[model samples]
Target chain A: MSAALFLIALSAVLALGLGVYAGRGREMGLEQWSVGSRGFGAVLVFLLLAGEIYTTFTFLGASGFSYGLGAPAYYILAYGTLAYVISYFILPPVWSYAKKHSLVSQPDFFAAKFDSPALGVLVALVDIVALIPYLVLQFTGLGIIVQIAGYGAISKDVAIIIGALVVTAYVIVSGIRGSALTAIVKDGLIIVVVVFMGIYLPVHYYGGIGAMFATLDHAKPGFLAFPASGQSVSWFVSTVLLTCLGFFMWPHSFAACFSAKNRSVFRKNAILLPIYQLVLLFVFFVGFAAVLQVPGLKGAATNMALLKISVAAFPPWMVGIIGATGVLTALVPGSLIMMSASTLFARNLVGFVRPHASNAQTVMVAKFTVPVVALVAVYFTIQGSSTIVALLLMGYNFVTQLFPALVASLMKRNPVSKQGAFAGIFVGVGTVVFLTLTHQTIGTLIPGLPEMIRDLNVGIIALGLNLIVMVAVSAMTPKTAMLPAE
Target chain B: MKNIRLLAILPFIGMLAGPILHNGVEPYILGMPFILGWVVVWILITSAVMAVIYKYDPANAEGDEP
Candidate 1:
């Protein structure tokens, strides 16, 4: 069943990627390819904005957290909605700033703001590296979506790997437009699926959302609360902070935000995106339903809970559509990840490394990187259970170092030191690696903090430390302030 | 500036409303709780904010049409 669905999804991805890239060849130039000629409408803006939010992590990780944590999973809803509203004001100012200066990537903004390519490159590197594990989750999602649908007997790994390769080919060929067009279908389909499931799931599984949570709460008290069973307040605080801070850090967010013709759309999307989050109120139930009904497999089956529960509940065709949408969710964002990664390689890394490369030459180098990284994403999805949301937050933590630098650079004083910016990132990454490897998750990963404050949620903690060091060091340092505005 | 000030309040309102509504605190007005009422209010506020931003035509935003 999963295999059949897998093949159909693979074709949709093929059509989506090739279709967009083919619509307007790379002639749109780097800027156009990356940002859709900077004239996207309300519809494209809406789809791209929504697509940036609804990644594989939204499906697998949010629900998985719900599966494990129960009601407090509402934090996913809280954070998701909170993210949109915050963006309303923050993004408009950023959009205004970007327009005033023609900022391309988040790194470009940081670089111009700090008056240092080194700082730009520093954040750029963080953006690219942080996105890798996240990209892997998306492909792994495709793989699992395929495997469950039993798509004509193709193995899940094969289905996922194939889907990723096809998307990569067109992303390489077309650049950003390729990814954006496909996002339209993927984002649209998921919204439809979510709306259907949101209303239907509770009715089918637990009489209503109220009843569902009520049943789960009575059966398992800790699951319904924010501080999950055996979890502490410190962990909850840190995790919510990590998730919130991570919002702007995601690569897809950077790509979509940069492409906006003006900040107004960014502001509008910011205000409206919470409505999408409201649509996601279903995720809490999806996860809780899995915990109550689905056969549990430790953390092994967490990623599959969505598909398993969906397939187990609906008819096969609806399963096929949901499965296809899930694959689309993975592929749509996955394409953006690779697309952004490629652009960074061509325009940022190589351009930084080579310094005098032509735009054509840079694009060539980026086109080459597309497939190689897609292959790496394939490797992770195939061999692993796919760390969906966990990986994205880890990416978020790394990106937050740039936030201080990001906000600082745009304003009068980019009071963040490039050296300190790098230092904070180094410490942030070190915290994630040390904590994650030591078998202790931050917040929910470890189930408790105080046990490891320095361990999990390193991004927020390190970012604070980074700010302290950057400001103190900047005070002692020269006052050249890299102000890049009107 | 007045509109912008009102706009800023929207986010704080959203943040406050999030945890409360999704916790499934469904008190019906006629049938819908203060929560659903809040959501309707949120949508209204968001529209108003957008309308304000559009109408204000902040000097920086005039040349740009996103």
Candidate 2:
């Protein structure tokens, strides 16, 4: 095998070995498997939470986004810092509540908070739908990275299949502990690889980072800043805000909070996480470097921009190292997502059906479902042709629909009834699905709207509809007994 | 003491205002487009602001651990 492919294979074996070893000699109950039995201290919790930030999505999608859309890609950096700020306040209460209630999944938190098992089931369904696309994005990135680094000796389909099997093997056995252990290595490798490529490519190609921007501005005017309309200032502001609200709404991120040993872990992390987000600036530099060097990549093909430029610029061993980092990026997040989705399925959906199912039985069902989730994501990764960023945004639209109800439930009085929360999520998710299926944006839906309002992210409309429905339903429905505040 | 938490809102304002007030390619900040530079600065500002809030917030006071 080539040096690059050999490196990738070696790293894959290393990740599998570390992941399985995390579960060695430990009891594997649902709580232990899903949330590390709520025992993770500051460092492990930090790695796990930060792990969500540097996924294949950031490794590949962020760079590709800058390469394709330029200024709009800055939203990636903007929303995450804002999300960390939001998480500072929100996650402490969430972690405390989860600790008290012994909640493992996002649906478990909602179910206990609202005192409604059906709402939990509804949330599980919505989360599964949202998470599938995200998992598919990781698999798609893995496919592209491995295929490119292997010099195209392997097909993308085969690469995805192998990646899915490896992730499934670890997650089914080791669960969240596996993801946390692998995250340490993934984060270390990605930081080094992203920073090196980000700085090296710019200096090598255009003498300095400043000179690179000067050359880009002269070659493609207005590409580095938002346009007046379409993906405009309005779109940038709205997209950033919407994604910020939705960031922790991803079930894996929500559940990851439950793993923290104490409430202060989140507060401390909130201060540090934004600095971590600055690492994404390096990711954008890599994308910007690719834009001028490897030109003419359009549509979904743009997702390959980072890898393409790497292949053109670096020798086989260096490409292999980058590929190895990419593989771990996908596996770390991919396993977490698969684990979360399966836990939601078995614990929330199936447990609702069989309300008396024992904890061991629930864990068993979850273990069995990991490969099934991997299979479904693999199928979609092969069939879907959307750019990696587009897939994530689509998932964000659906998942963000859950945010209004989530925040409302955390209120001191929780003005929203369980019925209201259910009605709101149903309508919000329904609106997203309807608009997405019809390929209709707010601008297209309501003709003659002003450009500023029209170009706003369409997810905002769904969120607005969710808030309205939740309020109306809450007013009409009798309030359920509120959970006693701490 | 309670009002200290409001410091977190600064990042939202600074980051969201980038496109509206400073969206441009010219006058690059540290070799980045104006909007990109605006975001990078705000990220640093956010970290600093949160650090201050963490220092003063009553929630983090000793013996507050649950």
Candidate 3:
């Protein structure tokens, strides 16, 4: 009956209830499960996409980076805004294509557009592998939130198992609608918590925002600004560009584009989503406040700075609310991507293997795979918790290689042949994995690289190689005259 | 509207150029340091720019379907 446990129980029950409510009266179809019947309004789509945006990485890791890495953390805010800007151009065409073709997932889009089901299967395989670490990242963050909230009475392992079970059950029963419904509540709590933490913490401890910056400036000069050192300016620019390209490539976000009511909904979201990016500025504020208040937090301990400061400043009940917010941050996105990943596997990959599967059978397979995928993520979370963010970045790197293929299919003509696209993706993702595993600098993979290439993100290097191979191979293939799909 | 796609690059400039131009923490604006302040300004400017494109871009004129 303690405050922490009470708040935890309350939020869990509320989330489950919302999940069940969202599923009521909706027919059980692949379209319903994957795209929420393709009937959601601008507000619903906004909430769903926003739910995917403000994950534990945003709430916890954003602040952690601010405390630990300083100015490099602004890349989070920059990338988000740029993503919305890019979405203005990318998503409308994608939405109309999916609507016209009755596509349900990323691989579905690729399969139909490229007129190659084999490529669809390949895309599905790559995306599902990329998503596993992402799922692990969320569950690991969820366990940390729960354990901290319980004041160490509850262990991280038990919390992670319980969280995985709850999320799997809700997603299996309600699918993406469950995620959208829970997002409304989750975003509401996040707004209040972010505003409170942003303003109150800075003012209470350091007198005001201006004063806090002044003190930090004196203590650690250039900490509030981007360092021209190891984390260089080129790193910032390339990271921002790479993230913007890969943002919507996440299966869940790409699928949410199909759920939009119309093309205008995406345009409106592009205009409105920047307002949401403002929230990260406040989250950054929370991290800056923690820098001096809670010093010397090393390694995994840095991720706890925001929470530790909140517990010290606020009452246990309020701290519990913050804890619940953190849990939802992980749970909502975790449920969503799991649903998307499972549906992708069932529809695209499994369908390729079986060659004859009904829509009803595919839906059943998607539901059945939820717990299997959840348990795999749970295994990874327990084995390797600290590398969650690195895993997420690796996912982004692999997913961004899909960007060129997407652009070719979405915008270009027969300039990119199927063979070219396939080879490009293989080489691009292979380079990323190899460079990452060998711990080689992406820009300096080859000796005597230019400063621009050396300081840039490795993902961008792989993307460049991807585009080059795609174009070169396409030009070598025989030309075929054909009308555009649109 | 044919040129609306060009507006996409505006955010890249606002986000990328700010650090290369004013990476130092001086000339605080509205109580925020210069580099951080540049990001905030661009977020606002990107919204306004996208709003302009949305107004002229005819892709969404088809209206909502039931």
lDDT of each: 0.64, 0.90, 0.85
Docking class of 2: high
Q: After superposition, how far is residue A250 of candidate 1 from its true place, in Å?
A: 2.2
Query: Could you estimate the TM-score for every candidate?
Result: 0.85, 0.98, 0.97
Model 2: per-residue Cα lDDT over A110-214, one tens digit each: 898899999999999999988998899899889999899999989989999999999999898788998999999999999999999999999999998999989
iRMS, candidate 1, in Å: value is 5.5
lDDT of 1 at A315: 75
Whose DockQ is higher: candidate 1's or candidate 2's? 2
CA deviation > 4 Å runs, candidate 1: A1-7, A10-14, A17-22, A25-28, A96-102, A228-234, A385-391, A417-420, A430-432, A438-458, A481-484, B6-66
Ten residues in sequence with the least summed lDDT for candidate 3 chain A: A477-486
Q: Write the per-residue lDDT of candidate 1 for residues A1-486, one digit (tens) a residue.
A: 354464466556565645565555347566766666666766677777788668777887777766765544555655555556556556666666666776667777666655678766776788887878888877777777777766336777677768887777667666666667777767777778877776688778888766765676567754554342234333444555557656766655765776666666765665566666666656655766777778564675676777778877877777787777777777778778887887776777777888898777866787788888888777766667436445655666676655665565555655566665555555656666554455454444445445535333444556666677677766776754555455
Best by DockQ: 2
Instruction: Classify candidate 1 by CAPRI docking class.
Output: incorrect
As a TM-score, model 1 comes out at: 0.85
lDDT of residue A241 for candidate 2: 93
Error of 2 at A330 (Å): 0.1
Arrange candidates, best lDDT first.
Answer: 2, 3, 1
